[model samples]
Target: MDGQLPIDTRPWPVRRDAALHDQTMQQTIGVVTKRLANAKVTAYAAYPEANHWRQRAVEVKRQSIRQLEEHLATFTQQVESHGGKVHRATTAADAIQTILEVAQHHQVRSVIKTKSMVTEELELNRALENAGIAVRETDLGEYIIQLAHEKPSHILAPALHKNREQIHALFDQDALVYHTEPPASEDIVALTQYARRRLREEFLAADMGVTGGNFLVAETGTVVLITNEGNADMVTTLPRLLVSVVGVEKIVADWSGLIDVIQQPALSGVGQRLSSYTTLVSGTRGPDQWEGPDEWHVVLLDNGRTQLKDTPFEDVLSCIRCGACLNVCPVFRQVGGHAYGSVYPGPIGIVETPLLTNFEVLPELPSALCTLCHACGEACPMNIDLPGHIVQLRQMKQERHMNAIGVTRSYRWWARFWATPHGYRRSMRWARWGQWWFVRHGRIQSAPGLAGGWFKTRDMPPVASMTFHEWWDRTRGKRQ
Candidate 1:
């Protein structure tokens, strides 16, 4: 992908409205998420020990985050011992600056990158471009979105919001720019072939490579990348200078720790046993080595992650970015990732964006984005208590008086009303009578006020003429 715009800066409601109204995005996201969610179930079933692995993965991540500093120190020592340099970036600006300095030191003109969410977080491509370095995203989906000047709508599938027809249009424009032919048809094979041809040229010509690490093994100073495409391999091998930007939380104690959680992102995300490619970089190439970068650097980024340690939000750092929660989130299914208006999307994003930024940005994401279904908790391979975190965040917001007065009052009254049998019975009676205006045939077709939004796409059965409590009192009182 080439020069893309900054992340959407629109207000949450406006961004959400756009996603809801875009029929193409809705359909595309719905189909893909549903398919992936179902596939995750089937894949888990096929492996009898899936539950055990998930539990073990959770343990490894929990322990890793708990002892993060110790692991990070070991990882740094090992990487340096192997000739790879380590840069500890305390903020987004620091990370970007470090990478730019490395690129300038090597006189990198053009850079190629594999898919990296961390890079997206730093808006690394834009920063590199600002410094007059040409940056290209090598992942097919990322390249497509790069051409379209958009951010990823889904974590695993960057272009999940796009359909085949829409992709053909983007590719056709690229083909014209390159003075080459477009795909013969809107087929997957033809589209990928065109991309492969274009990216192959960049792979050979680029002076530097950039990647996001999935896991870093402290025992050996290794950076692990799991991908379906071989672009990461090219990025690491062909370029003289290769830089990996990873969250400090990504480091594990050792290879045994890496083994415990490596398959999780693939299995929980897209139901694959493993991605098509897994590349590990221990260091820069040795004199005897025929392939690999001459200069290797790993920028371990904190950027508020360290602030989460020892806090209730620590479980959030365990997220492997698998995106399984998004596939099953009802709210995410309807609104899509762009609506969340962050680099990350879905359940994890809801907790992460607010936490990473310390709720200074998008303070409403926790309360607004979740349905509290707990499906995200079940779907997470790391067993991150996403729903629990969201609830706590919402509580934090409420304590800070971030919610609207009217909404707060409404929920307060509703909770009070439902706390006792008498109030509940009285409210049910009021609802039965008050719902008459909206009721037609056998259900409440529409509602007034905030309730209206729910009824817009869903109908509710009218409150029954007699509550179970009332019926039991009338019938069983005589028998008693």
Candidate 2:
């Protein structure tokens, strides 16, 4: 939101290069993801009931999506009954337009926001700024990136890439506006205090506030904003007019459904048993509440999600945005979020983006990026079957003639060899003799010619002289 930081609107190639070159991004993502992944493993070990909870969560989300229309109607009526306005948007453009109209109608000039992936997906900050309104991000992580003019490298920790020194420098650059020089100390507490002080003023001064909802409880028409830092609370409570932008798929059938699916993953994803602040706002605050917002608006953005319902990919909707999958993904751990060339990243992005955009632009992600470990699928509370979706995407690419030349040829060879057991055995026999040149101490050190590149970083095992089936047959005959 700061005007000083450089804007990065370049195409995917340029953006990817920038992200890759960011050493800070690399180190931050590595440390954070590793730590969180380990913590989750420990937490699950402590709670042997996690598998049971996961199943219940998946069922709740499935049922919610099945009865989505009914739930949405009920939600709308509940919100309206409590003096809140609900606006439905069919696309990103429509959602942006609706928000702009609401801001203009309220005569709002400056806005404060909490971290919301949905808002990031819509690029609402850019849209509002272009309309000549100033916006400030209240969440600490979001505020740091807002200053840097960079996209989030991770969902839970948006500015996870920044260290103390870098953050100190960023604060120094913007300190003049707060009427104080940046503190000399690089301690965590000092930096946090400085950011809190600066953001608190913006919270009080802003005419409008915007946040993303974690879950929309259809039974009560309540919007839940879960946070550890309490920034979301300020964003929703202080401003006169508060608007919440939520993806339509975030809806749950009832409060009970939310209890079953939404809270645990959100908590575990961040290494916390529960967030410090869990505020539920059903409608505009009444006069009896001494300090609270007066007007409320909930903008439900469909943004291509309706088409995904009832399909295999509909399970993606069950994601609570806890970011568990991002922490465990090997590809995401290495390249970070920006490499995905989308607001959403990791296994979820690879599957969701193509489906949401209808594959208009081919994503640069490779099928090889996935080791087919199914780790992400296990981590997902919704049991989205992420590996299954990735395989489906690969099939789609093959059908469209977009698969790489080498991959297509490899698959063709595999199909031929698999069609006949005799042919496969004959090929294996030839391969064993052909591999002798590369064999050293029972391992293939490197292959000759084109195949050498595959062994550059790995040692391939030498092929056995006899096939498994042949050995088994000979052993059985001798025993008889």
Best by TM-score: 1
lDDT of 1 by residue, 116-161 (tens): 9999989999899999999999999999999999999998889998
Worst 10 residues of 1 by lDDT: 1-10
Assess the local accuracy of residue 352 in candidate 1 as a C-alpha lDDT between 0 and 100: 85
TM-score, every prediction: 0.92, 0.88
Superposition error at 223 for model 1 (Å) = 0.7
**Residue 265 displacement in candidate 2 (angstroms):** 3.5
> For this target, which candidate reaches the highest lDDT against the unseen true structure?
1
Instruction: Put down candidate 2 lDDT per residue, 1-480, tens digits, no spaces.
Output: 000111234665676677678888788889989988888778777777776876887788888888889999999999999889999988888889999999999889999998898888888999999999999998889999999998887778888777878888889888975668586578989899889888878988999999999888998999988888998888888899999999887789888888886556555686556678887889888767776678899999888788888777888887777788889998787778877776777888777777777765434443535677788987876778899999898888888888678868877886798789887887788779899988888999897645677899889888876667878888886776
Q: Candidate 1: misplaced stretches above 4 Å?
A: 1-7, 417-480
Assess each prediction's global lDDT (C-alpha) against the native. Answer: 0.90, 0.81
